[model samples]
Target: MPLILPDQLIDQEVLNQENIFTMSQDQADHQDIRPIKILIVNLMPKKEETELQLLRMLSNSALQMNIDLVRMDSYQATHASQDRLKKFYKTYDQIKDQNFDAMIITGAPVERMDYQDIIYWKELKHIFDFAREHVFSTLFICWSAQAALYHYFGVPKQEVEEKIFGIYQYEKKKEDPILKGFDDSFYAPQSRYTYVKEEDLREIPQIQVLSSREDTGVGLATTLDHRFVFSFGHWEYDKETLHEEYLRDLDKGLATQIPKNYYRQDDPQGDIIMNWRSSGSLFFSNWLNYCVYQETPYQLEKIKGVKVAKFGGSSLASASQFSKVKKIIQAKEDREIIVVSAPGKRSKDDQKVTDLLEKYYEGKKRARDLEVMIESFRKDQAAKRQEAQEALAAVRTRFQEIVRDLDLEEALKEDLDETFQDLDKTQSKDFVLSRGEYLNAKILARALDYDFIDAKDIIRLKSQDQLDYGESYKAIIKTIHKGQRVVVPGFYGANAQGDIRTFKRGGSDYTGSIIASALQSKVYENWTDVSGIMTQDPNLSKDAKRIPSMNYQELTDLIDQGAQVYQRDAIDLVKEKNITLKILNTNAPEEGGTEIKDQEDK
Candidate 1:
């Protein structure tokens, strides 16, 4: 119902004519907010339908946007009236100096001809280049997609012998920032006669295939430094527009199958299914909100390469002016498990972390579900910390009992849980696990007696401010190692490679082991609330026994019964990198914690 300035407008549209962050005229009855300035370069021959279709999509954004329709002068087929073009549209040269935060180039029906052959090809190219340099970001639809890709990235398009007209389904090549907030397997309306094959795009490394059909290839792109994005299919197509084409073609006796894989019944006269419309709108809105708005220069003229020297500095937003959506997450070209997050949750008010992380992976998804897992972890950590604290308190009580009794073997022997049958189950287990040296050593560290140093020097640090590092990122990750008391956020890490990395939810055990392997810790003590790996569930086994020590092989076997295991990742690292791991109760730091040594260490 409202405009949600997708990426493009989200950043650069802030202080310009295209700001979608306001209310529309229909809602004008209530408020006085400035509306977003939106310009559409309607290249379609049927101007009326294209106008209605595009306007419908733009009007639905969460942000407020006003539509300004800009059409090219008659360059090809004849359809729109001369008076309409003259009255409603202005050439790129006419609006060259006027700053727009966002713009769209619709697909025209001219695909059979060469790029240079279209009468307005040169003019259309001007608009294409101008949008990149001037508008924060531009969306080129169908014919425009081919023209712009060829013009901008040198990816050539060829006219296919058969018209690739149909309701084609596309598998996402990989999620891109522009497609943020989209559901998996989104569809776009395609009714074109030409194709831009992936093979043709290989030479230009800047162009990336976002989603492609197996038959037609390359559906969308956000390449050339992401200053330009192109959608080969019409995500903004009016549902009836395609139906109109199908019916029109059938009447003309032009051979056509009922827009393949479309309408539920595949009947030409069946009820039109608009399943793809929802995702299509979501994709476009995200692009405008995130890609364009966040990245466009604050000034407008610099895009045309004109220094603001004439205006005393204020033509376009500075190159640094656009708000950053997210840092680039580069995949390491080496041996290591790569973790990917789900499309991120947006910042509470005016934030786009999903956009940020998409930008992080260079717009290619590595591991899906990372974002949801991180959010879930943050929610659970508080409860975990409280459980740990209660355990620690009981451990101290046990330490005092041990000191007064002076019988380590007797206290350690005789069913440990039976010794504290009077306490609550949780408290009883905490009391039993709390032995002499282990409990007191940790309590010593807690009280700041400083018997040991936390190994933070080996792990990366966090800034309550920006968790991801800037240039200072290098200095922070360069400072981690063993015996150095340091605190690291459990779910995250900063690679020396500049991208901040993270682990699975509750993957602290895994992270600690990896770090230990990297440092080759002589004794990688992984402290937890448990005494050691317990054999049976306490609820299931009234007399469940705790196993003290086991080699990696034996421990991993027992751990495989669906319980969260540590040694899986630890040993993975140990075997690959040759390091050892130890499991200890942080509350009970000594108690000869499970020494999971390899065969050689034993």
Candidate 2:
């Protein structure tokens, strides 16, 4: 069974219990195209349970995924049936020669035992060594994460006083591509007897900590490049997984407590609250997208050695800037993907597209030159409605003029009217905010004779307005035709209800970074007003000089210090992918601008 499994044993149960569907019918139609080849090495003792859990977690994306189950060559498990292993699992030697887009190494039950004393330690080491060359990316979970960290980075794990078994709250240490759609705080299930110290990870320059909790130590960690991810939490666990573990321990007369923040009100007999399920889904999906799908070469052999460059656009505010961008693209054969922001102010007196939209939203809520404020929840008044209509009409006029100036034909009137009416019905501020990028992108696409793609159709956001990394990547790759010059609107995506939503301020750059990461562009060129990133604000100090280059860490420090070089979200999207980011000036395209590279690259 591959991407579109017709009747998996766990499909119905998972679908009913967790709502994890592999792909839509539309996505299944694209199966004539090659599917991502993924290999899962099941090291857990309860092979069948782990199989169902992992498969369910991997099933939500639109990517056509084919999975191969693997087992250690040196050891036989008495827990899993030998017949099942023979029928379904492939030994390491059988698949070691083949290449995989991604490989997942599951947690083993032997954490207290010494690494050298483990029965399959030698075989596991061999597989790990093979994965470096044979796999594009690898996800190491729980005990496996610990083992790999020890083997690769020489990081040691220390024994804890007691087994850490509960649903714990973890906060993101910093943003990473692997956390594309994660909230500020999330819940994850931890069941372990030993933990890797935060200090140990700090000593390793290559390893980056992702999620950590005060009570539980490090929850997730990854390498600088993110080709390898070490996850301490059981992100693929089902709702009752921890409960089942606790029950098993209690049955053996071993001391165990009820999982914390798990069962509703901490009563074991009460309903189990599934807080960690969404976080788990997001984690797996992100690893698949940013680490595997985006990094893996289309031609499997090409993965042995590969390089990438990415480029993007600025706030194409005026016809002058638009022409400059077009010239820049024509100058280079490699400029394939374009990220377009909303038009900015053409002059001092002119209003930015986003500002105009925000003004319209304000007008929609209140009548001009009146003491009374019009509320959306109340019945519409004629005078207030007239004010709102005039505001929308003004915005439409600007779009029409821009389209006309660009000498492009578009159904701006019809689409604007429809979208405006939809917004009135829904009263969604994001839908209003999105029109800035939407209109500009359409105009730019027509002007350049490129395909106009709505970010909503590709960039996916959850109900919580967080990005769905894997699904977003799949949507982009599947929807965007290969070798086509495509222009995507920045800042917005559709939520779970298919309603428009937007990112925070200066999100156009964030959108640009995401597009670059997904496309694996060679260099992400962020064209803006300034020459490049300056050492200090130009207005604050006339002596401020543009930095020629900086590493991701330096850039992060600068942003934290109130520098406005990029939106906070942009760096994380590109850093892990190793995509070079350049800050270039649209006015002076010929001048060499600031180049952001890896610390080693600089």
Candidate 3:
């Protein structure tokens, strides 16, 4: 989507050459769709360049975004002209009354100094505090991430031994929705003198580490709910950004280390690898799609107290099923958290998305050349790779068509394209296996007008293969809140090792139960094909009727006796919490299916 820039101020010819859409005020006034309002508090010295860079990043998404540029009233900017600032920018005071869909606080070149020592620190603190109430989501980049961490959490930043200048590979600490479609590891450029330690972040329970490198420490951290995304590295940097900085430092005779893993053979004159661009694009697009566009309330004022309803993919497999789910959600104002699985089997011979993924995985065989056993032979593996690519392409195309048919945000279609590309770079069996649910969750979120949170991020498991209920529940509680409808994908959770793990068959039910129990929800509605559990095996006895009510004991016995309704583990998770498990049919939700409860409840 296009960024709403001032037609007179922005060079239309330049934007056109770059393919960036800019609308005049007169043009914007007539549009029926309300553009997402984004506020950028540009702190970088080169304000215009930063403006262009940030706009380019925001432009990749399929949201009609309106940009409001702001400059600090208390501080003077030396790099940008006063006339330019006065013409295009507004001070925080001027726009304080208005609420924004999202805001971006860029990095200032003052990280080495104490927070209080900066001239505009006081005003910046006010803006930071203002964001909690006025902005639906805020992104703190580089120094701002550190500043927010210190101001809100009392975390202190320490100067590093040397400038951490380089393109470094960071391990994704958790599977955040922000990092959805991201590989197991990705590279980001970092150039900083001061840093926030991951240990300090751990002290504050609300702060969750999203990504970190072995030596570089925490690269990204955010509040458990992801209302705020803090990026320590420069994911917005262009390919030659580091190289330009390196050259400038060398020209000035400043002490610096060569940016590690950046140049070919560590040679400054050699070709620079643009490794972070793909991940960067995906990161920004996800923030715009999941966090800003979907999470923020349309009326703006309703954002504070929205409820959550999580819908599984099986319940939303078709248009009719989606309509049923929508009706069910409309009946309750407080149900907004949605947990979606990938599309399920429509017929006996039809394939579930998850099943197709397993087949796709099979096509990616590691072929080796006997002559050179050290590495896989590209030529030998070409045919298999092509086969895998074709299978994966079908899955991607299927989801793309669904999203298009549903009239979702254009950014979502772009996301599908990027996700398939990211999937091609991964060799992890589990990562490839989980794309089914991830894509499904995105589609459902768009269809239901709810934000999608990846299960791999919030659902925690121990390194020993046991559920880490304490950490998992804490994270979920921090993330999901009242007045917000969110859909989390099911079937898998990540362990301490960052490996995706799944439950037995019908794990999506298990995932839903965990979310409900954790939140102490009023009821856990498990939507399925059948109305509810039948009196007997329906397949065996045609006379079997839908059971209107049952206790947990009876449900467990039926499941144990091969009645394929609810998983035993799923029942056990929510049974103790007294959360009534309502099984409603997606196709016939109006029929009002069975409600399973404790024996005393009857």
Candidate 4:
């Protein structure tokens, strides 16, 4: 039950004074047991304080643990001693190859800033990616939880009008291993400027909300498999953490509110209420026993894999659908690379954007009408933030540029005769058709706050009808960074002469497959409107049932027989790579969708 830590950790003296049992590496080596390896990616400015708080909570567990501390090497620490960090902590690069039973990423004070603007954001993404493949389970605390939610699922944190700084009561919402103790309601400390909505979390099928409150929103949540745990409240905070935060804020001349329910009679000088300690200890103990110790493989090296998710047109049709796409992407950490199709029909009577573009290209629709449709789509995708508005304007300008040389004699087409002379009609048509996906990817990237990668930049085409796989693989490797969530437009790529060429309609599925095969992803997830492949078309057969799973050969046979659930070429690509394919419903994700895999692998 002793914690194995560095011999001279800066906080060791404080922990010793508190009578927490700790052992040096030399002493732990002499022991016969294989101590659980725990990595702590400490992000709090007060390094020593955070270490003591986390070490105290972890010390309550009966299982012995070897705690390895890590710091972000990309950013220099101003509050903590550089000498101490160099001596007691390791950087991400130093331990990138090592596996751990569990890892804890502490909260930082960068919640208000955009994720990309943070100096160490790139480095932290690598750490997050490493944990997904190497660490058995990861616990994200406060701001880290928000960051992880955004990075993985595209769930953005909304800033509240006031900071939630106090002890709040959260009621148990669901029964799970992470919340094993008996408690209908419990007190936990909350000190944050932002919070994630329970409604948003509920949309993600993979996440299970464990505890929540009317006032505090979501307090605790975890993935259904317990691989990732998110704690919005700081259960590891010391009794005076809030008090110190209040004083610090006041000293800086900022308006500060008294921490609610933390003192007798709401007086700062009154006796402090320490009701959360018992629940906090029980929570950490349960996490160790149930979430980590019982589930992790004895050999840590056995843990490794990644998933590529592709959202179809129907799944990313409207603003609401776009939100669903973000949640699905964020639900699993391994779903790092996202591929998106153009907006589809929002309702039975609605028209897909791609169809509208095609009609305009064929001269069946007016150019003015097409422009109006595109503008409406742009407004629907805007998020009411400055960045989204800016993206909206940029997307509108790009659309205008693409249609500038159109043969239509409208106010939109000026100097059409001169422009037509220079325009290659074939290339212009391909560019116009691809804008549906291009604009959607731009909007989606802004909404999710992820990098936007144009498919033409990486996916290479040998000709209008032929794909260049070798060149595409090399280009994808060169352009995309490992572990970064990026949004890529599907259906179109560039040829050897740098001319834009498009695959046949419904070719986004093929785009996803190529990326999955190029990345060697363990699984390729295709999200559509239906739960899975049905035995018969639901529109025709009232008793149509969903197929839980099928083999690659069976799927190929179905395609050969004219089943239209997936693209035939996409199926061939994934089959050749031996990548497992999952057919998921973006709307009704809880239903176990169909899975396609090689028979031998299954």
Pick by lDDT: which candidate is best? 4
Steric clash pairs (candidate 2)? 308-522, 309-521, 309-522, 309-523, 310-521, 310-522, 310-523, 310-524, 311-523, 311-525
Better of 3 and 4 by lDDT: 4
RMSD of 3: 19.6
- TM-score per candidate, chains pooled: 0.46, 0.49, 0.53, 0.56
Give the backbone clash total of model 4: 2
The parts of candidate 2 lying over 4 Å away from their true place are 1-31, 305-602
Best by TM-score: 4
Q: Which ten contiguous residues of candidate 4 have the minimum total lDDT?
A: 415-424
Q: Model 3 lDDT vs. the true structure?
A: 0.79
Q: What is the C-alpha lDDT of each candidate?
A: 0.52, 0.77, 0.79, 0.81
In model 4, where do residues sit more than 4 Å from their true spots?
11-13, 306-602
lDDT of residue 212 for candidate 3: 76
With a 3 Å backbone cut-off (N, CA, C), the pairs that clash in candidate 4 are 152-330, 153-330
Worst 10-residue lDDT window, candidate 2 = 305-314
Write the residue-wise lDDT of candidate 4 on 1-602 in tens digits.
Answer: 89998887845667778767988888889988889999999999999999989999999999999999999999999999999999999999899999999999999998889999999998887787677779988999999999988876678888877888899988888777777774888899999888888988876645788887766677999976677899998999998889999999999997768998999999998888998999999999999999899989898887766577899989987767877887877776667788888878779987677776665444422332344565665443332333323433333443344333222224334433333223324336687678778767866676677888999999999888788887887787677765678999999999988877889999899999988877756789999999899999988989999999999889989989998999988887777656789999999988999999866444
Model 2 clash count equals 10
**Could you give candidate 2's per-residue lDDT for residues 1-602 as a string of tens digits?**
23543234344665557555554445656657767888899999998899778877887766768778888778989898887687778998888789989889999989999999999998897777666667888999999999998876567888876788888898888999999989999988899988888878875545789877656778999876676899998988878889889999999997887788888889999999888888888888888889988878887654442112222333477666777777887786556677777777776688777777777777665643344644652444556667677767767777767666766535455665676676576566788888878877777777778788898898888754478876777677677654678778888888667778899877878888877766555578888777789877877899988899988888999899887788887798888666678888887777677889877433
Which residues of candidate 3, in runs, are more than 4 Å off? Answer: 305-480, 484-602
lDDT at 53, model 2:
87
